[model samples]
Target: MHLYTPHMLLAFLLLCLAGAAFPCSAAPADDGSVLYSTDFTNAEGWITNSKDRFYPEIETGRYHYLLEGGTGGYSAYTLPQKVNGQFTLEFDVTPEKTDDGSSFRFGIGTDKKDSQRGPLLMVELANKKDGRLFYLKTVSKENSLNLVGSSPSTGSSGATVRFEDNTTYHVKLTYYAADSRASIVVQQQGSPDVIFTASAPVSGKIEDLTNLYLTAIGDGTSGPQAEGYIDNIKLTLSPTHAAGDEKDAKNNKGADETPAPVITSAPATPTDEPTPVFTPGPTRTPFPLPPTPTPTQTPKSGLGFLVLLPALAGGAILAMRKYP
Candidate 1:
């Protein structure tokens, strides 16, 4: 008796292969002196002290936040050391809803608990948009959304970013303490296209950069609920600034005096190249990351391999069997 036809077997094999495939967790610039990091594996270091419903919570290895009614809370984490010197921050964040409210802010400051009340250097996922895309600008005592808003050049995509809803974006924000400058690069997970990028001087002395804060707030009035999730948090302090950058910092101080560096904007289309790495400077030179441990990625030789073996066997048997 005839069994399955060649076409049927081919379809089955394809389905099996599809079942075996999966996405890899996104990789940021991995090499550095990791001062602090977390995948939200638990709630040990973070504190969420907002009112009952509008506060952030730890769940499923992610920091999830829901905001509405113009109110919100923070995901605060005390750091091992104060944030200073040249450093880089990398993480995975998804803004589920920013259609309403002012914006969501995150970064380092002296405030152990209240970051917004201190000398903060943060990246603001602003509610303001350039055309259809929202602005990704840096904010501190000096760089406010109002100042950045004057036809803000592009606080644009690092390259090409749709900044779509409910999609995770891996971000790298590098700070050059020497010049008080911050540059940001963001890309959707599993891809290497920098959808949003900006390099602007932090503009003033950001002192006592002590704690880490991800304070996601919402519009004061009820509207579209603003929500977000962050994962794979990493903070790296480059023991020192890039070589000879202190002098450069002095030379570049005038940059702040000139028309403030507009948080230029644009969307970068996805590319097959590896993820782009940013050094704390204007050159945008490449920095090779140190080798990553093998544990992070899902292994290919696990259960999927075992299951695919049957598909391979079934395909071979059906292909060679007589159909008469």
Candidate 2:
């Protein structure tokens, strides 16, 4: 009753053709960026709304954001995906308390149905008992660019973080549509401690990021209205170029990045189709490249060859059937 020995039947026929030559996925690595992740459990594609003493619900996993003690009250979600150039808006807010009055405004600009939305780009986490406006804006009726510190703990480039009460913040906004520029990072979701950071410059080209346009302002004299819970929602769209850090951000996007254009080497047909690139598909983390350890490109071990190819195809179909 012992068979399968031809070097264990060629390692169980390469572990029963190893899941048809190695395949196992949980999905997540199409880094073309224009992504839109969610963990709301359900309520698909979301388009919620509320105003004047706001309250927008979807609560079972999260998306609840009430502000019922207000002045110019509001609540919104209207995000269906429209970001055009570069983007990375992540979200995971949760504040139901910490002496917050209210203001959470997540980003991606101008689209409440656009009657004429002027190029927006937000991150205004404003809560005020006396001070707090964690900044990063990019409006455009003509001009607006507030980065780093808008007030209360400093504003103009870095130093802002007082969002704590029921804490669960993990915001990360990044837009770079070739210098329309943007940056905002706040962490404490799992806690790596980079409280906040900001960057600015965007007075044009914001025709619309369409939506993720979540808001939750409060104005009951700024002290007890803006509550929260805006779970995992993410959006990604910044992976142009042939990868490898966007080809080193396009060879250091010119701040006098000169080796005299690689010693005057003019012969580019848009840089030779990405210099014989091999890391295809918008480059790195459009998910699994066969468990990238990148020796030459793949198969370094592949999870013990995909757990020995289904236990060698269930022991060669139960030692060739007859399980009686």
Candidate 3:
């Protein structure tokens, strides 16, 4: 049950015409300067108006923004522009659960909907009883949130910061539209210290911000929901701190003078295919060996004996023929 030879049916029709002339995927390039980036792998333009308990989950690869506590769970993503000036946002969180007055908020803003109310910038952390508070705030349509900073903490009110449950942390924000300000930075991924470092000073120009959210304060679903996982989200106008490191960031206070983010290099991916040269196959010139005929002297010495016998016979025949 195996016979197709026409050179195997033309090599199976040239592998089905080279898999229909190559094209397994190559259409994700929008470049409006990438205002949004995702690691959700496929959360498709993100948005979650809580179709039921604020469900956001993109399994094993990470993106599990749940929220329940008094039920104000949120999730958002809108940005292709708006973030007007310098920019850089990073992500890779890991909290996992929260209970006492639960909290968690991510940021980037110009909020949109929930009945209009713009302006935002976040990095909250809450867990009070005076213990796990991390901060940095600014929500305004004319002064609504306004806290503006916190990050060198440990409790006893130096400002607290107790993350440790799935422990992943990497956050990084850097909005500096000529000093309207925004600079928090957290570490914890392969730590050498730095889970805090803060700065805030907003009044306007958060580089013209847009939207990028992830909230989960808790109160209604029995008020106690705040879990986390988020992963790799990124946005960049590059330059997150590397110009003399802003005077070493005024000594970010601990973890050995925190001054971390400076990783740049991303903006090259637009190919149509041009890199395939190989050419090698034509080397074999070895064929010449057929001339050994001198091996025919096999008569050895018998040849001389035969010659003598013929001479004697010829003489006798000549005499007989003359007599006849």
Q: Whose lDDT is greatest here? A: 1
Worst 10 residues of 1 by lDDT: 143-152
Off by over 4 Å in 1: 1-32, 51-59, 112-118, 129-162, 216-224, 245-260, 263-324
Number of clashes recorded per candidate: 25, 14, 14
**What is the C-alpha lDDT profile of model 2 across 1-324, one tens digit per residue?**
755444555565665575566555444544564467878776465554453233335455777665433433443455565567766677887866434455555566654522124466666565654244465666654534343443222333222245555777777776666656566666677655555545566656665456655543323444455566778777766555233543344344324221111101112222222122121122212111111122232333456766766777676666556432
lDDT per model vs. reference: 0.56, 0.52, 0.53
What does candidate 3's lDDT look like per residue over 181-300, in tens digits? 566666678754554555555554344566787755323445566677787788876333333343343333334233322211211342454322212123311111111123222222
Q: 1-324 in candidate 1: lDDT tens per residue?
A: 457776677678776666667534455443348898888777577676664533335445677766444445666788887766777788887887776444556777655434234356565555543422433344454434212321224432233233556788787777766666666666679866544455566645655577787664423455645577778888887654554654444354323223334543332342455433322344432222322334345445467677777868776676857442
| RMSD of each predicted structure | 17.0, 19.2, 30.7
**TM-score, ranked from best to worst:** 1, 3, 2
Q: lDDT, candidate 3, residue 301? A: 37
Instruction: Score residue 53 of candidate 2 by CA lDDT.
Output: 32
Candidate 1 residue 228 C-alpha distance from true site, Å: 2.4
Per-prediction TM-score to the true structure, in the order listed: 0.58, 0.26, 0.26
